[model samples]
Target: MFDLDLWREIFQSINKNKTRAALSGFTVAFAIMLFTILFGIANGLENTFEKFFLTTADNALTIRSGTTSKPYKGLQIGRLITYANKDLDYLKKEFGDKIQYITPKLSRTYQLKYKKRKGEYTITGVSPDHQYLEKAVIIKGRFINERDVKNKDKVIAIGRLVEKDLFVKESALGKYIDLEGVVYKVVGVFSDNGGDEQERTIYTGYTTIQRLYLATDEIGSITIGYNPNMSADQALVLVQEITAKLKSRYDVAPNDQRAVRIGNRILQEKKRLDNMTTGLGILIPIIGFGTLIAGILGISNIMIFIVKERTKEIGIRKALGASPRSIVSIILLESILITAFAGYVGLLIGVGVLEAIGSSIERYWITNPSVKPSIVYTATIVLVIAGAIAGFLPAKKASKIKPIVALRNG
Candidate 1:
């Protein structure tokens, strides 16, 4: 259905009214371009907010023991539940493959000293897995390794703030520091951008605490990190399974929910992500279509003007035996071509602007603001439909033109 003569006529008419046609096309193009930039920035802002919520691993969970709140199976309500090294081992043995990182965690307030500098700070103990689980960034040297944990080395990793306070003008790495009466060598200098609290804590090998300062096998907690993409229901299933196993092993009653507490950081993150998704689901259509409607109306109005200008020509064609369908088809095809061309130009410019913005803001706030190809295809399809609808009324006007009246008016 290619018609060279019809297209030639259409292009000739367009060229004749270049200024007016350009104005109409620019109107449509500007509207679509605005919509694309707005949508991309909105998506980028959402992602930036999500990053603030995730200071640690994206799918992290924590287990801590608590006193019993209710009596079950004839047990006393006031008894305190406890987690030990055995619990950490059992969980790792049973669910190791399902987890990305698992670590035993214990923290105690201690007085730190180096020469004349002295301050009270939190000293945490952990295995090598703590590096990823807590988002620990070791700026110099290395974090605790497997050999350090097994050998119970008296090596420690101090936070940047701690280094500033205790070491003063010298590098803290490979230096000696005193905790109470014991001297432990600093193996690494660490920093965390999360907050001030994260930078106030120090880390040492897990076994160091048990072998030197602590006499008991009991641990403060166990933390687990898993894949973030897992559904809440699936994660809950695993959580419940772990809870049941812990309760059973520790002699706690089956129905007592208060014997232990679980903190699901992943679950919290997933809820936020879902909420953001829902917001986007409602936002895109309202704003995008609102802008598109304005452009569509402009295209419709321009097409009507074009039909009015061609009234005498249409009358002559009808007198020469042109069918009504042919006249309508010509008008519709011209409208479609104009609308489609304008929309494509808008899409190209919009995508370029989004990329420039993304590049400028990638490190500080947003990442990959515009997913270009996805929205491009969607907009292309929308432009076609919009063109059809925009042309319909004008095409009808062209079709209804009586040769006698049109000739007289001309």
Candidate 2:
């Protein structure tokens, strides 16, 4: 089925109309380029969102108190609501086995100083499990441990930004810093986050903070890290059950309820981003296929024109004992050759553009935009289908032309 004469004729015909051919090729290439860029952007956004969520926490829940206005079911309004240490103790005593990690935090704003350098930061008094709940990565030294909390040691883990400001050109670990006149030794330095590192924070042991600051038996908030296998809904339900039990035991009204506030918004946002990416993934292929169809149509139109121009040549070949199948094959081959070459060029250009642009747009949510191999393979298949379809109609038409009619036209 490989005819040298057919290939020669197809090549000659395409070479004769280089400008029109180039225009058609450009159309296909441009469409493919647009499709590739769209796919890359969607992919980048999804990756960034995932990274942002991971940097925060994993399978963790947060609890906060909120003011309620209306009295509900015999409960009085305007009550000062708070979740106490006793409530936390009760929850842990009842559901210790079900929980993975728990941290009770007491936060306050204070000026942190080391020698002459001073900056304001949020000072958080947290238990040992706080590091696990927040997924805090210790860049230097070690985070506050159980010994620090148990002994009520005046030790702190500082964020990277705070270390840079308070202890410039020196290791912050083993250095003593003042937190509102209370001396605390820096045990670890954490990574910088969301800019303004010095303005970010430092964490210390809960009992140490309580003892040093003379605020015993009081906590600001509680963060709970549940088992990875547990769903957010399940964690929330457990928190609700714990809250109800605590309220009943304390004889507190529903409006005066001390309840856990689960913070699973990051997970929710991640799921939303994933769904959006999936939709875009489906959409990109449809657009790419549509462009391919248009390119095929252009090839078909050119093939039809080629058939008309070569009518007498085709007729003479037939008259001289050429088979109808051979005549059809020549026309089909020309159309397919043009479409295949143009599609390939388009695909290459599109991929090249993606590679070039992907590097410059790195962010937490939209990093490293690149096309998947599966998508590339699928597009290649589409191009082949387009080439075949583009050639089919023109080949069939050429085969039907009679020698007498074609001769008359010549």
Candidate 3:
């Protein structure tokens, strides 16, 4: 099993055609390297995209009422949709602590003024929990609190853009801003310096705005934040149950003409992104494995050719009382050595490249595209399997060769 002479002979054969052997080994190595690199980069890109999405309230779920599609029981299908404050109350009572944070929002565009300085702005009426839901960064003073909603305080939190336009170098905190001749205190300023700031949006307590601006006890929409441990499917089921109860209490049809609208856009988007990442991860390996198979085929073919060309030498060994199994083992060992050594070299090169380029690549969904140790270990296992497969057929053929026929060819 441990014949020194057989190993020496196998080495001698490979050393004689160093260029050919090197080329075959390199082919396998390069394929595996390329496969690892491509997949790693794809993962990095996905990471960056996910980060961008998260910065804008990753966990927020909005429920916007949409017009009914079909006329139910001869009633008009195109009725204006609305959800009342009572509906929110009902949902709050039913779900309780199952819902982490909930808020009703009413958004409208209006001209905002601080003395002579006036600008068009989007006003949002939201509860104190809206601050937690959006993770809104307050640059100055404080956000709307429970007291503001209770007292119906005409207080507002202005975006950074509004401060730049109206206040200029003046301090924004505790300053009064006019909304349609009604004065409201600027309790906070947001550091949203992008297009969100430039649009000059204002946030106020939801109940305050509902009393002042909107005449009805209805809300424009509801925002909800579910418990992190709950799956999207679980949340959806809860929401559906709440909707059913609300419909029954309101004396509305199951497929109600006045049904409340609810949606989890964040959950849907997150699921899509996850699926995409998983697909890319799986696809890259499959393609890489194909390349590895190609390299193995090349190695196998060359080994077969080596066996055929060395027929005379093999026949002489058999004539000298070398067993068939020994001949097969010698050839198989040579094939495995070539494959494993070349594969290691290739893996090192690929990993080095990833290390070099990882930091330079822009942050994506798959940040820092480096090969994991597990991945390398997996590749090593693949190399071993490929090496064995490459050697097997050639070794089998060499074992079948008779001493007489092989010696005559020589």
Of the candidates shown, which would achieve the greatest TM-score relative to the real structure?
1
- What overall lDDT goes with each candidate model? 0.79, 0.71, 0.75
Count clashing residue pairs per candidate: 0, 7, 11
What would the TM-scores of all predictions be?
A: 0.70, 0.67, 0.61
Candidate 3, residues 176-281, lDDT tens digits: the string is 9888878899999986523564336899988877888787778888887777667656766766876777555644468763455666666777667656767877
lDDT of candidate 2 over 1-410, digit per residue (tens):
67687788767867887876676566556655665666777777767766676555556667666444556556666554566667678768888776778888888889988898998898888888877666677899998998998898999998887887788889999999988888999999877444554336889888877887746677777777766676555655776765666556644555553332445576566456656767867876677667656655655565566667777887898788888888777766665565556656766777787788777778435687777756754655565566566556665676677888878886
Give the per-residue lDDT of model 1 (tens digit) for 25-142. Answer: 7876887787787678767766776676556876678999887777767777878888877887898888767677888898988998999999999988898998888788999898
Q: Which ranges of candidate 3 are over 4 A from the true structure?
A: 1-32, 48-59, 65-81, 169-171, 191-194, 197-199, 264-273, 280-410
* Candidate 1 backbone overlaps, count: 0
TM-score, candidate 3, is 0.61
Q: What is the lDDT, from 0 to 100, of the residue 255 in candidate 3?
A: 74
Best by lDDT: 1
Q: Which TM-score value belongs to model 1?
A: 0.70
Provide the lDDT at 398 for model 1. 70
Residue-level error in angstroms, candidate 2, position 55: 6.3
Native-structure RMSD, model 3: 7.5
- The weakest ten consecutive residues by lDDT in model 3 span 191-200
